[model samples]
Target: MSIQLGSNQEPPKQERSAETRRQLLDAAADELLDGGFARFTTHGVARRAGISRGAQQHHFPHKHRLVTAAVHHLAERSLQQLEGITSDGSLNSTRRVLDALFEQYAGPLFAAMLDLSLAARADEQLRDAVQREEHTVNRMIDEWAHRRLTGCDDAPADFDELFAMAISTVRGVAVLRLLGHSQESVQRQWKYTRDQLLRLLVENRS
Candidate 1:
């Protein structure tokens, strides 16, 4: 759920700074989504953000900083949506949240993250940043599952591994779908994976 802070008043200077940062990150996300891994530049982002290059550098002195911030920014948004999805002890709630998670992985969020992931495989500096961000994201999801999904907190040690595997399988399926896999094949595999996870979730709660 969203929590609004402060009075319902006009924009303060600090709020304006926050808004500028948000706009820059959002523009970076759009650029990354459209341009893929190689097309992100501070100048391009500045142009897209309708701000000066000096302003961009003020917020992000380096390209890596910009990209890293953008990734974290987008991730927070995705996680917020994930956090908002309601779940109780029920199997149906588990299934719905799982489906929501799948959608989170299938969209531009996934696309942007995949770009960094691929780059990280070869670039050590980028790899370090990516890993750090990934750890944060994973930890957030793990906590979210344990807290929001009733049976998860009481699950065994293997629950982490099982849940992680479910996520990896979804990523694999997403890649295959991108490579022109049949829709029927994609749906079949998705069902099998999702159902397996859901079953495990329910069984563990029993």
Candidate 2:
């Protein structure tokens, strides 16, 4: 006989599975941030997640898969946050867009991405995974920028190139933060870069 569910009953199996995966990915991201890829391990992630090793292994069979999945998970979350920020009607200015993008790159997500990227350089398998995810995320950002910045189906022919440069510049500024540059110095440099990018965007659209 099937048991009747009560208020204290556990969640359904599918939901529990999804929650476990989320926990593992969150733990994996923290592990990467706390200890770069060189020291990242599924065991450590499982420990951080407060789950058994078997459980994490059941979800992510290998270290590379776990790490890459963690990066993808974090990237998706960051992109969602960006979408939310850009959706606000009051923030419909080029400078605001740049600010949102800069804030995105300056967060822990980018720090985790940097860790994966550095480690990927020496690991062929991980490199492929990281590059694939990077390409996917970049494409998503390109589409997002086109839609948000232009608000039209037809963007300028050079729009993508110009946005790519802007993103690269912002990412460079983010690296400065990771490199231990003072907050004041980073802000000074970003202000200069932001103004230059704003000018470029205006010229490109004009």
Candidate 3:
């Protein structure tokens, strides 16, 4: 008599492989966040992932490949989360949009990206890999913003420049948080920057 597999049955090999890869990517991001790029290692990631070193190497043989892949993986995950948060129609106003963007920039994903970017400055191969990953993520973000932002359809002539400035300002605040700044100070600075950007947007709309 043949037995039927229940919902609790183990996943297929392919599904398990994908799950392992996902875990490795998550662990890789955590390693970068906890130890930074300078101390990141494949063995460390494997251990953090609770997988064998050979398994980790099977997916990513080089450190640069692993970290770059992790960066892209985390970015994709973060964007999906952002979509869920913003799709509820609660982000109706420009201020709410700015708040969401700032929260995302200050999150662990951006923190990991910043660490990789700084390390890339001295490593040519890693720099190339990081640049490629960053370009892909930036394109994804641009598409997301176009679809979700409120004023894009009637944006100013220099909309891209203004948007770039907004992103830069948020990133600067995020870096300050990473450097152990006080919460009150960070929030104050972010409020000032947010107000300035809102004023610019309003002025441009006129």
Candidate 4:
């Protein structure tokens, strides 16, 4: 139940009882990645992580707790991966970030998560967490788009236009990829989409 923010030097440590909790989260992620949330079980996670069932309960106590925490952890990991991709200031850094994000869940894992997301509509808490994660990710993307678009004085007259276009373009690419499109096709279409969006953002820029 104890969490510490990162300090100036070393990484913050979790509470004494958090080791098992971390393991449960890791196991849940593997289960979700392999079989989606429908197949996720506390017992299965415990076995996968090499801990007792009671130990898993001692950490999660309920399935919902584990579900929410695992989703949050995945979202954070995705963000960190993006941060790494964007670390370099190369011309294709943004494209690299987008590609990296898509690469992680390129196959059945993405499909499973999307199915689980649809199924979670009946669960208000789970739905809210998913919405919040999506909001955070989209907000970051929007901010990056704004910065890139606003680099020059003669860029788009309205920031909202650029943000909306960026959001719509990415959403379209994701939907296409999830609907059984090949990765090669996704990459081709994504390149076109990215180029068009960048053109809109920097079209009139000095």
Candidate 5:
């Protein structure tokens, strides 16, 4: 099964196949957002997408595939959002991107991901996918940190550890925010925490 998003300027008529795929994905995301991952079943995705169960199965054979695809879709959207941050060609770009990401996802997205991780304990495939996404996000964060470190050409040997620490710090804020902390308070504390983390990274740079 293939997924496509047809261009609006193509013609007067919308493509049915493309529209169906979009609906499926969009609806799945909405379901995940509305309820936790446990609440997101294949039937629920189909109902939300307004597509037949057979069609959903054609695209995604199982619930795990649908969930993994949704994770990838969200990751791609995030990368797109960071495109500008990457292109800034300044060390601050790294920090800014991290800040923006935490700000954007500290609420619902982070909460949903946490829910998914807890759900993964009983599902091996889901556990693997969640781990994969964690590693991918960590790699991105590590690369950004390396770029921003004082010596970009020769980062510290423990760069990964340091990067993981910073990621944890941000994720802690996300959890707190998701649990009803005020946005103003989260942002205030987050900025201070980020600055301190960056300073430490800079100091540790080889």
Candidate 6:
């Protein structure tokens, strides 16, 4: 019989721990996206992350914190992408940047946020947490929009209003996918809006 030494196993490396944390957050994001709060489960997330239940708990002692952290993780990643894209003074580049920003609203992070938002409508503590996270995200996006609008020649006096409207339209378009709208239909509307918005920006008009 071979005897295993109990003390021989090495503890997980710092890099490994961070990786596991990321995996758990990603799994939580997916869980929130797929079924919102109704289907969220600590065990389910742990399994999805390929980690043991204890391991998950060790990383996130509370489930709510984990969910919030998952949103934070996604926000951080989006900010990185936002920073990477250069703002060349061209209408096409502007469109690309806008598309990327809109993508963050349409992607898995947004789904997870929708889950949190719905839950927060009734839960006070959760609502507070979600609001704080949302405020952080909104602040970042606010700066991003302002940055994109800068250095463009002859921007309209109502440029702020126009930008707000455009953001709202893109966000609504994102929600349409959740309402079972076909991609073809969504794409059609999106393209029309894209073209018109591109022109407005390129022309620097309302």
Report the Cα lDDT for residue 150, model 5: 33
Tens-place lDDT digits, model 6, residues 118-172: 8889888889889899888877876786687555667777777777877778788
Better of 4 and 5 by lDDT: 5
Worst 10 residues of 1 by lDDT: 148-157
User: In model 3, what lDDT does residue 112 have?
Assistant: 74
Name the lDDT of candidate 6.
0.79
Candidate 2: lDDT of 129?
Answer: 92
Question: For candidate 1, what is the TM-score?
Answer: 0.81
Q: Give the whole-model CA lDDT for all candidates, comma-separated.
A: 0.77, 0.79, 0.79, 0.65, 0.70, 0.79
Stretches off by above 4 angstroms in model 2 are 1-3, 87-92, 152-157, 203-206
**Where does model 5 exceed 4 Å of error?**
1-22, 87-95, 104-107, 137-162, 201-206
* Runs in model 3 lying further than 4 Å from the true structure: 1-10, 87-92, 151-161, 202-206
Task: Go through the candidates in order and give the clash count of each.
Answer: 0, 0, 0, 0, 0, 0
How well is each residue in 1-206 modelled by candidate 4, as lDDT tens digits? 89775655543355535776777787887877777788888788889988998778878888877766776666556555555444232336545544554454454434555766786899987787766755654566555544543444454467567657666667668778788888788889878877776565544343
Q: What lDDT is reached at residue 64 by model 2?
A: 85
State candidate 5's TM-score: 0.70
Error of 4 at 204 (Å): 3.3
Residues 1-206 of candidate 5 have per-residue lDDT tens digits of 99686674454334766677778887786788788786789899998787999989988888887876676566555555655554232347546756765764574555667788888999888899987875675466446534444335545568668767776777787677888888789878888887887665554452
Give me the runs in candidate 4 sitting further than 4 Å from their true place: 1-14, 87-91, 98-112, 123-125, 132-157
Error of 1 at 170 (Å): 4.0
Backbone clashes in model 1: 0
Best by TM-score: 2
Q: What does the lDDT read for residue 25 in candidate 5?
A: 80
lDDT of 1 at 17: 88
What does the lDDT read for residue 55 in candidate 4?
78
State the lDDT of candidate 1 residue by residue for 26-109, as single tens digits.
Answer: 998788888976988889999999999988899899888788878778878888888777776577887877777667666677
Give the higher-lDDT candidate: 5 or 6: 6
Q: Is candidate 3 or candidate 4 better by lDDT?
A: 3
TM-score against truth, every candidate: 0.81, 0.83, 0.81, 0.73, 0.70, 0.76
